[model samples]
Target: MNAINSQKKHVFFRRVSTAGQDIITQEAADLPFREKLSDDEILIINEIATSANKKAIKERPEMQRLISLVKDKKVHSIYAFDRSRLFRDFYEGMEFNDLRAKYDVQVIYTSVGNGNMPASDDVFVEGLLSMFSDIEGKNIARRSREARLRYPAKKFGYQKQKETKRFLHDSSKSKGVQQYFAALKEISSLDDLYKVTKEYRKKLKKTDEQLVSMATDPFYAGYDLEKGTNKLQHVTPYISIEEFLQLQRVNGEFFKAFLERKKSLMCQNIYTPCCGYCRKPLFYKIEEESNSSYYSCSSKLHPKVTVSFSDLSKIIGGILSEIIQNFNAEKLINQSINCYRTIKKHLEAEMDSIDQNLNGIIEELVLGSDDYSADWKQDPMYKRKQLLKQEYHNCLEQIKENQNALQKNKSVIKVIEEALINQSNMNPSMLCDMLINGIWIYGDNLQVDVFYFDYLQEMEKEMIFEGEDIA
Candidate 1:
């Protein structure tokens, strides 16, 4: 389409499902409409070999171009052979109509395709036919998809026979795939599985999650879960159903081991996120020779900044013990109580704003409503009213939740205060994250930064809620 923004354009758009078909006859019938239009004002949109049932309007190349013209307000009118040439579904018709409405464009259908079904003049009749066409097109698409259920495309580690169309194992990848499955027995953690993944999955590049999903997929076991015993999918099992079950057991064991090894380290992940010197994330690793856990930076640095887990535990324990001995628990409890009370006040003010806004929209909807119309439910105002009611209910739910939190906060504060008094009860694992900001080990000096505080305003968010109860 030639988009001369200053000038109006009349578009003649045509589509055919296959390369064997053409819009010559339709073009001849539409030629009369073009005679009245100037050369600059005419835009011919021809979509060849494009299936409306297979592809949507946006997916079709020529149709997308025509839509762009309409959206830009460069189109004055659209001419087609028939409605089916433009729309095979009701949604397509509705969308095309909406675009025309927005850009002040007109539409004209010359005639029906082959006249098996005639084009109607009445708006009501056209609407009924459009709905039927939409359902029929969807039914045809479903049938087409079902007809090609046994497409020759084969999965990984297999190939489809060209002559017989039967799936057979490719000797090359099948051996590697089988090896990967066998290696599952040795996998104790995600690390072991990932190393094996790097070795075997040279050709198959996939994310960690995708590899896990593919490992569990039943298709590799030579059967579909939906297909009963009478029918297995046309694929040879490189890994037998029995072997697949064994591998799943191994995978489950690996998951358990991974979770078991993960421990709560006070300054590992959050507070001491990275090595202060190297600026690399720190992770926990066991020294194989000594079998001692150490928090070390991932990056290898000169004069490595690392700390032993046992040393870390003692350092954090000492800090918390000293804080507990000197800390004023009564002042903290009083401040926390006042904070919750202030939060409740803000929540109440927010609820009031939501109510006032909802009420104004409800009044406007009631005033502008067409009482006699049967399609009042379909109105934009009616939809907005429903949305406002939902928003109001959500705010009310939040306010009620805050009320419950206010009561729970008191008991939680009391329990936390009691835990601090008895230093033995205060687990450094729970309190250290809130108390310390960062820790850096350099040469012989171990440095710790205490978390800064806004004494008047801030509170550590639900440390009691997250950690185990000490009450």
Candidate 2:
């Protein structure tokens, strides 16, 4: 007992990919202690210190914790029932070897009882085990992908038949799916569909990409993901194949138009401007029959308030004309440039500080002396590190925004000067993009706010117009 105490390590690390009832009976929790450690060794039983999931990814938090423990000399050795429990890939195996060499940490496979240092034969055996596990994982993924092609899995509007395990249309959720697809067919754009199905959006909360993917999914039309001309009409379909094809075409056009319009100035500010009554940003939609664009509030309480794009242009044009006549354009441009430079300098300095702090934290982590407590999630330094990362990204975004604003202001000055010189031929779209910040509509009244590039005071001028009299 005294000799065992002298030889036994301070800490023993144990890991298993599975811990619940599914684990093989022979490789249970007690087996590791029985086979691997002597009576004097102690196991590290902390939840954060162990990984028990099927995922063999190296980026897992549990794996990181274990690595940290080894690097910090908190654990002298790691014990697993099998080599696969530790790693299943050659890259990870190589990484472990490097860690072992640098830190003198022993990795023991209890089932085989290989000693302190893995000999040349033990290294070869470990490599083979990792290679086989990797191959098995890949084979499982390939089989699963093939199975999906043969017997496609149930999707949004489907359920499996209990008796046969085949997919069928679920009556309970089919109504909503039908209505959604039907609405997609009628609407010209996602913006129009979103306005029409505001209540449904509240329930589903699907993004534009999700909506598009759902609408275009071939499974609704009784087709598989595999490339085949013949339709698989075995199971029940919620939507007709013909209708589904038509919706796909319509969705294609909607996306193409959306992409084109997103490049325009009005689309950029459409969601930024808010409704005075409900404080919800206005959404833009195009009329199918009249081919005219209109902006309306997203709030259900104020659905009647809407303004035409042309009317908005006219109202905003008058404001810009007033500004051109009253303000000195050259002086404003120079002031904006100077203001942008000052803000940019400040943001860059803050970014440098954040980078320096982040580097310090990373260096500490590399040296295995990070002051971050074991409860890293709750540690103040860990929280500060996360905050610094977020701030760094935000600062980058602000710098980009500032650069864009400076370029836009310069463009505005050039366009305004040209418009003043040749008043007959002015591009309203260009002017709108350059000067107008946002527009708010309330009942029949509209407020247009223009951006002033001067640094001295609040750089915005608001003009009110009655919508009924605009035309």
Locate the minimum summed-lDDT window of 10 residues in model 2.
45-54
| C-alpha lDDT of candidate 2 relative to the true structure | 0.64
Q: Which tens-of-lDDT digit does each residue in 1-471 have in candidate 2?
A: 122233435343344433342344324543655465665565443222233223555556666666766677656666554555566566676667677668876665555543223322356776666676567666766777766754665566788776786778777778887777777778876577546445455545665445556776777777764556447666566677778777767677775555355445344343344576886777877643244677777667755778777776667667656655565676878888899999999999999999999988766655765554566577566677899999999999999999999999999888857776454235555655566676677886766667755532433445556656467
**Cα misplacement distance, residue 278 of candidate 1 (Å):** 9.6
Error of 1 at 470 (Å): 16
Candidate 2 Cα misplacement greater than 4 A, ranges: 1-21, 24-26, 29-40, 44-59, 81-84, 88-90, 110-154, 183-208, 226-234, 240-250, 253-471
Root-mean-square deviation per candidate = 15.8, 18.3
lDDT of 1 by residue, 67-168 (tens): 888887788888888777888878787667666767877777777456634544445666777777788778877766543443425466778888877778
The TM-score, computed over Cα atoms with residue i paired to residue i, of candidate 2 is 0.45
How close to the true structure is residue 244 of candidate 1, measured as C-alpha lDDT? Answer: 73
**Structural similarity to truth (TM-score) of each candidate:** 0.43, 0.45
